[model samples]
Target chain A: MQLEEQTITIDGQKIPFQSGQTIMDAALAAKIYIPHLCYHPEFKPHGSCRLCTVMVNGRYESACTMPSVAGQEILNNTKELNENRRALTQMLFVEGNHICPGCPKTGNCQLQAVAYYVGMLSSHYQHFYPYRDLDPSHPDYVVDFNRCILCELCVRASRDVDKKNIFAISGRGIKAHLIINSPSGKLEDTDFAVGDKAAFVCPVGAILRKRTRYTTPIGERLYDKQSIRIVGDSQQLHAGATKYGRK
Target chain B: MIESLEGKRGVPRNRPPFPVTQGYLNKPTVVNNVETFALAARIAVYGGDGFAALGTKQSKGTKLLSISGDCLRPGIYEFPFGVSVREVLEACNAQDTQAVQISGAAGTCLSAKEFDRKIAFEDVATGGSVMIFNRQRDLLEVVRNFAHFFVHESCGFCTPCRVGTSLLKNLVEKVYTNHGTADDLKDMSYISQVLKTASHCGLGQTASNHIADTLKKFPEIYHKRLLVEANFEPAFDLDSALEDARQITGRKDEMAYL
Candidate 1:
């Protein structure tokens, strides 16, 4: 693939990147991490999770959505940006059913790791404490609704890449739910089979490899301080791929 | 507060017999929700659509959201009505997988299955965003905690919420702690419906509705805890009976409290 070349400066560091890449892609390529949830490199950028927010020449923009332009000066990893990211992380915690105790994905989870990175120690707001459920019907995978942060990456991947069109969002706004195209609306009834990338698309432990839970020693699992790119790669990101490589 | 028609009378509880039929302060003052009054004031100030101009076409005026969680992003956001859930998340920079908690205590909990949904009262009424949680988080524990909270905070004016909430919390906690039987879950559901129908205050009535709604959507988790199968054990493990006693006595230090 012929790439369009471009140059941009992030956090005062000059970097060259392809023109078509989103600002987040360029930041990740340059190894300048800007916190984000919705934008992943392997899949198309949904830009729904706005953790990769940055300042471009003084205006706030999402690194995940903002395309690179030559000579563009971007400021990521700023204290202001970090504060915003911290606040966003806190909201996700108390909004729904997520309670991070003894969870298999605890330390290694992207949401938890990001919260630690941003230093969100306390939440002054009232807890929403929504009721959620776990979908362990899939023999190979699990879906824990409580832990879900509503980042539609899995939905997008399932539809766009997998072409399964199995997972679609239901309800509206705060009442939305993940309904399967089945009679019982359970995960077991869906078209998802073992080892499908769409089933493994969740960034949090909402989707898990069912039989593999606690089977791999804690230190050996994908989440033990290894970056997502290192632990799991784009090969498993979209459907029908199995390549996972270190960044 | 809705304009109480003139001569609207009677406090929720029976009137005190101190002055006989003469009520306290005579004029019968009415109390209203803060937001309700704010809306009333907005209607008077900007007219309907002008105030409505602040939000989406279907949802008018400003909405207050208190965001919290393990999200890559979180914070309170005020947007006009008709705002899509995606847009609200963008404004607050919320995580994608995180489910949204709707309304205040009287509202329901929403899951990711509903992300494409919009933000409107008719849609769902989460007054503000609390925190977001990831896969490592458990929804049952959160619901139990919230139920316990309502139970303790409830004024004993009514038996439904007052006693029902306390009972609901214990019942859900039993399930969470693994001691609860499948019959206990059935009893919890039955009691929840009874409270929803019979509770006097808003606190007792809808306190368990969220959990009930969740059970309706996902019954497997609740069923798994029943341990009907041979050698089946529950995943959650926090002592519910001891916790309930502690709450009742407010004495965690005493062994008798357990």
Candidate 2:
């Protein structure tokens, strides 16, 4: 898409991007990982999660939504930026119930992988230990509200691709949460099926299919096979029993 | 306000095409302050130069200040923009004033040393809300009150403001309640820096400005409250934690208490 080449320097490496592409889009297409959680290339970039915040000409802006300008100097992974990113990761960890060792999505979840990538050793801040409910009312799947990071991936995917509009984010600030659209607020009462696009977009263990919790086992999972930067969108590329369940 | 006028919660919308270009049900609109309208009518009647003849070279005209706290005259007062803070204090009969919060809870905290600073665009600018604190009032307590206000008022939209506001409040609590170490102050600087830079909107960005300003100007207020011999102390209390369980089980016995 280059009539004449346009480039932006990210952490001192010259990266070329076409018109209308964001810094995250160009960085990802160049196989350079900038550590994001809420951005999916398939859907419009929602800048909710500030995990991909980078220095753009001395100011911090989210790389996922900020359009790349040619000759702009950007710092993606500086020590200070990664330190801030780690703190943000820590906030997400403490804001909800995120017990990594027990979660079925542990080895492959993007939240866990990003935490590892940023070297977030602990929650650091005090944990809220928020009590959330589980909905196993659906015949084929379950919804665990505790593990949801409010990324809006399921909300966007269900509306935009599956056309069901089953999930929505409700509440404000620290009290914000994921909701299932139904009269009883149960999964079975809605038109959500096991094969909808929303079914595969969750990056955590919030949405799970029944009886496949340990299907792939821990060590051989998508993220376990490689670092998050390498095996980043393995879940988005294909759909199957073994997919990491992201898109 | 557009959202409020449209009968919804007043959450701010992201802008590219600003409200001037596109706003209020997608039509181009201009929103002005109430003061601006009053001044506009005066300008039309009296002409521009007559209205602008009062203040400094850069900052012109008079400002109506809604003042309160520790002042003998706790009411509205009109003054030109270039008036020194000490002059305003004297005019208001502010007795034993230690610190003057320039605007509101979100504005600058000017100590007695900075009283010579002028209230002008080129100097200490404000939106005209003034708060006077006497020497007896601990300025840190003023900040703590503001911190609590910010925590409840946060819209919880973005990550930094949603969580950082409460984090800052808790740090203030840790210090005032005597559990603070030197590290908590270090964390306050870092958290405020992130909040200032990374927030989605102005409310979140400016939430920590007063806290940062106070911490810089009045260091003794914080240092006096720190647990001197200790590097760490648990912030929350065990007894406070069990009060909910005590209420649920309906136990009044001594054994039920922590």
Candidate 3:
């Protein structure tokens, strides 16, 4: 049985997509950038960021979460939408202590790159300097809760990919934090390995590997070489395949 | 709300498998307003024809409006759905009315010119609330008050609602405190648009609704509050930034302040 190719119109461009693929998957596959965070190709789509929002049939829907319907009209990357995206990026910047220049993952950070891509010139909002304690309990990995965006990538990776259940998000709303699933509530106390998928799943400088700071320098980092739209995500590229990226 | 009712956090759930398909206890549930429940009860007792016979051609039955603010009769009044704002005001003995804030803080603001507008779904859709604002009332104060409400109520689940509300509150506070400039007013509109467009839930989406409505309908109030010459006012005051250090050292000296 042969199925006809399904296409969804984004910014007046008709891009073909598979039946089961989301708007993000189809758009990214076709090299169309719909700015998003908290959406990895390998993980389930979490529409918390609201950056990938598009006007679908006069209403807003998250592109990463919405299923691609044939002949559906989606408005993305418009002036109005880009402005809103910049505001959302600013919200993310103000939500945490995302000091890009001061962090080790400055150039390599997706949040910083996306901020640049969205034309976020200023923080725009008041900084929420919520006191967060740094976790140096683990000998090899340093956990900096200051940079966490509450994206739950590490939580999803530890639970789903590693099957270790090492990380979990505790509390609710602004009080929510990435918690280590150990009796002592520390990463070192858990049976977490350095090679775990959760260790490298962070899109920011929240989680860091010890003694690897400034190894590649700032300008020579992954995101510094190319924009995130071109390189997709670092996780897929380092896997030696472009499964969810340009082939 | 369903999550909170089920002993979970007060954060809103993401949509797709909506509350109809997957709600509290993962069962199909119909979430309705108190007014809607009252309507449902009335519909159950009286036939559909009886209810439909009242009001305008489009809107059916009566609406319960809790009329508050600068009105003489400050109580809930049951009027037909097509009742105009002027009629509501007259019924409540409201005098010298400048504007009418329909629904609630996150609803539309009607100027004296729009008093002819009716309380219908097609005309001025509201959940049955009409707060009157007389000529003596300052609407910017109202905006500031509502802004604080939204900031405290925000669940902080999503980035847009969580941060946007606080930003809106801060901006409104800045304006209220006379630290606002023309740029601050522009920034307020931009932030309001973002909150309206990208917020995850209705609370965040309509958090700045009254602000937007008042900005368009009553621009003078906001413009009058702006600085005479300054176009930019830094929210980060150098003196206020040293408050933590001042508190730590327990100093009242001028040098210790800044």
Candidate 4:
């Protein structure tokens, strides 16, 4: 009976966590992993990825978005939640050009790890058939369009937190494209510097540091050994901040 | 306007020789919008007051709203004359909205802040309400998709609607894909304006006017990407330039995909 303890049950495990704690954060602290994307520790929580799906009291929800109310009973690690997570992951995988063999970050990628963890064997939807262009605009960084998932986490990080509305979604529906704020639609013309959150926010290998591809093997990558819940356990406070990150 | 129930199925490949030369059924036949005929009928029946009962005092009669947006409940709702947008949104349990796009696919778009404003014929057209897009929805993309619809449905009869709608689709897509220049936006604005005035039929002209209306209301949303002098770069990488080139390269050999 710690003063910080709150009465809550997650997947039938009664756990004591601090008040004002997020369900994801509390669950991760208690060793209950919730699959998630767009819930980064270094940056803000962006719930747009919708990959961290879980059920709370019989209702499906994005675990990354919902906050735990006192006396609430939450459920994660369910068959249905895992299925939906797998399906949504497969969608992002197939929607872009995710050639695992050709991708440098294949083993180390968060998106790939999520796919593997969720049991996404193959894609059910049609490949977007988009001809992605390689942006060699920055001499130190490279942007490959084929691997982007349109999560908008980078856009939010660059705009709301970073005070730069650098990213915007163009087109509609199936034909939607992401446009850089540069002349001739090239990233080189704009102030897109390396190490900016926009350049590295991609969960996939779409945007990569030019020389970092072969520097680290897939097994030693950040996403390989740890669950996203563990990495994002602290920053889950921002889950309900925006529409993208909300429950 | 010489119109017939029989002409419902097979439209003409070219202008009928008889409509202009011989005239409709050997008599001069002129075509007009059913709305005009309905108005004329209203003048005869209600003498404007009865029609006025449906709409506001200034705009008498029932008009439609093509509202397509993100609302807890979204659809065409018939309201009495002078019913404000706030009232309409309230009646539908869609109040406290994030955004509101008034008019049809081709009319003025106002956000939730503007919902307190009145809903009049001056605001919405005489046609039925078509759609309403909520804040979660994207307006630029909505109008762009609608333009594509018009482009494909065009009968290709008149230059203004057929050619003009296609041109409009191209322009709207260009603005959407971030390839449009400031000159392209100007051209887009100009083409929509001209088509609104010059298209032979209402379908070709008014059907796509939402693009113009949205641009007028939210011009910043439609600003061409490459043309804007800014320090920001998009978060996601886009390689549309190669796709555009590929399209141009294969245009001649490609079959139409409408």
Candidate 5:
């Protein structure tokens, strides 16, 4: 006996998927763009960012975690869904101090790219502008909490791939934040190395290597030339660059 | 047990690999609501059908309602499901009831016109809270209170709920303070739609329930509060802040900006 091939329709486009694959995985495989953050291909689907929420059979579900069922009708890229995504992206911009113009990762950042893709022109809501401390104690890298979107990619990469267990997310809700695992509560005190997968996993400028801030000109960057949709995968750009210690 | 070990924020986790499959310490666990346990205990004594026969087919068993506000007798009332809102109000001896808020702040706020609606899984579902409002009661004030409650309770994990709650609170308060415009009311409804569809959790999703329900049922209350001028007014009044400084310096001159 052979297993049956299954297909799901997304925004009138029929896409095939194997069993145990999520909608996000199937969509990405078919080159269908679904705006998302905190959903790196290499890491587990952390549904903290609700950007990829799509209507499935008249109900909303995060495409990153929701498994694709055969003959399932999904509504993506609709006016209502995109409007909601824009509002959610705007909330992310205001929740933290996301000053894209001043940040070093303005052009290359996934959050910035996703915001642009979603057409988030401004933070519609008032900015929280919470004061977060910047940790530059690590000899080889710096962890700027201000830019952290709490995607937990570094946490997953450090624990799952690097086996360093140097990063963990602490707190709940808006108070949720990234914390260093070492006793001194600093990245330098932890066993994290510059070559660890965690260092290169951050989709934003939150985690940056030392002495390589302005190496790449603003215009000549990854996302500057092409949007995140053209790049296909967020983790791909920084995948082989880990050994060189630059994003 | 998951929340007990994970701390008391009461936020739920994603499903598929539910707590029953892989939970605390990567071990299987059983999670149930407190009411479920109580229902189980009652079922052991009364039998399944005995408890089930009391209410509607879809929603069996009795419901515990926490009714308060303008009702003459405001307290807990246990009644079988499928009871009408008017029947509940009559039982509680409610006087001059204008509206009923079912299921706490996140529930629907029904006007007197909807009192005939029954309480059941098939009808108006509730999680055991019903607040009565008299005709003299201000609906905007009720909405303002519910808005503030959500703002205080928001865990701030996701963007929609965290920021949306604050935005709802400000908009509701703007109407309450009589500085609201028609655009503000429109923005509130739009924000509510965004919260319901995009929020990460149920709290953010339902935070706008009271505001939305009231806006639909009682648009006049909001329109009455709208400023006559068509000009946009900021949420905050700068002149109010100057009142404190004016009093401290005791300046009555025109330059003092009084």
Candidate 6:
């Protein structure tokens, strides 16, 4: 039996999709950008960052997890949605110590790129500045908890792709922190290698190569040349094709 | 789409794969409030029009209010929608009702001037709580209590709520203790705006409800308590440190050695 094609209207644009494709998947395939932080095309949509929330019909729903139904009206790129996105970015900044000036991933960071895309000038909320410890025990890499956004990308990559199960989130609420599953509770004690997907999956400067700091000049980095939107759109285009094993 | 059990922290899940389509072990499910179920039962017994005839166009059927504080008769009162705040106060024998906290801590704190506002979806939408405060009671104290409650109840899921509640609590206490500066007041408003728009769930989103509403409705209460004469002040006071030194030296003279 031939499958019927479906299309959804997002921000007044008609985007076509397969039967079970999510809004995010279809939008990415169409090269329509929806700013998101926790959503990596490689992993399952976590829906935790909430940066991808869009109005469906009249109700709010996260586009990352919501499936695309035929003729579904989705409102994205609106003032209300962007304003909310900017506020969420500010909250991420103030929630932890996201000091961008001295960070290694200054130009390549997804959080910073998305913040710039959403036009977040400053962290409008009060800074928590909760003291979190850093772990440099790993010979090749370091784990700086301060810059962590709790996106759980590393956690997912470590468990699913790497199959090491080295990283896990422990505690709840403000006390929640990324933990190592080893006996010593440190990355050095765990079996996490430098080449593992978890090490390279951190969207922020939290996980870094020990000696690669400032290797790429500030103005010559990934996001420094092209905006995250352009890079993300191209990346999504490739991700969409690869998902269905298409060229 | 699994329902969070009662007594657990009330953070909402992200929608899209909403409970209706994918919920509870990935099976299709329906989630409803207990009150909604009760209302459905009522509608089932009485025809839809019979229940719809009771309330305003926007808000249909009677609402159950949990009334308390400074009222002669404090208990559950069921009244149809579109009832004025003043009318509810009169029915409950509320004394000198300076303010009414409609819908618990996360709800709006309506001032005496807003008594004319009706309890409807178009006006003041409440979730059953109605706390009446007399003129003698301190509004700041009530706001402080609310701040503490949010701090204690925060689920720490996202950054905005986990640390935001504690910061809000500290700011409220700073204002309550008469150490608030003009900057503190500015920060309070800014934080409230951020929490309202950013937080992961309704709890953090409305965590600043009491502070924001009280600040707008009764500015004098907060303005009068501010001790700082300048636009800003350090987190600590040096004068308090000098007083501590004086007590340690057992010296009553003006010259305790500067």
lDDT (C-alpha, whole model) for all candidates: 0.63, 0.84, 0.84, 0.61, 0.84, 0.81
lDDT of 2 by residue, A22-122 (tens): 88888887778888888888888878778898999887888887888998899998898898888888878877899999898878799998888888888
* Tens digits of per-residue lDDT for model 5, A135-181: 99999999999988877789889999999889877775567778899
**Number of the top candidate by TM-score?**
3
Q: Model 1: runs farther than 4 Å from truth?
A: A1-5, A219-223, A226-247, B1-258
Descending-TM-score candidate ranking: 3, 2, 5, 6, 1, 4
**Model 4, residue B108: displacement in angstroms?**
31
lDDT of 3 at A9: 94
Per prediction, the TM-score for chain B is 0.71, 0.90, 0.92, 0.66, 0.88, 0.89
Native-to-model Cα distance after best TM-score fit, residue A99 in candidate 2, in Å: 0.6
Question: How far out, in Å, is residue B138 in model 2?
Answer: 2.5
Give Cα distance to truth, residue A106, candidate 6, Å.
Answer: 2.8
TM-score of each: 0.47, 0.89, 0.91, 0.47, 0.88, 0.79
Q: Answer with 3 or 4, whichever has the higher lDDT.
A: 3
Q: Is candidate 1 or candidate 4 better by TM-score?
A: 1
The sequence of per-residue lDDT tens digits that candidate 3 reaches over residues B1-258 is 799889865777777668899998888889998888988898998869989998889899898999999989999899998999999999999999999999898899999999999999899988877899899998888888898888777777677877877887888888788788888878888888888888888888898887788878998888887766488888888888888888899998977854
Q: How close is candidate 4 to the true structure, as a TM-score?
A: 0.47
Model 3: per-residue Cα lDDT over A1-247, one tens digit each: 8977789999999999986788999999888988887878878887778889999878988888888889889999899898888989988888788888799988888899898888889997778778887888998998998998888788888989899988777775556677788888888898778788888778888888889868888899888888887876656634432456344
lDDT of 5 at B99: 88
Show model 5 residue runs off by greater than 4 Å. Answer: A1-3, A181-184, A241-247, B1-11, B19-30, B228-231, B235-258
Sliding window of 10 residues with minimal summed lDDT for model 5 chain B = B1-10
Count of clashes, each model: 66, 1, 0, 26, 4, 2
- DockQ of predicted candidate 2: 0.54
Report per-candidate DockQ: 0.01, 0.54, 0.61, 0.01, 0.50, 0.33
lDDT of 1 by residue, A1-247 (tens): 9976568999889888775777777777766777766556667655444566677877666677677888888987777677666655665665556566667776457787676678879642234567788887887778888877766667777788777767766653344456566778787887787656566667677877766666656666444556643443322433555432113
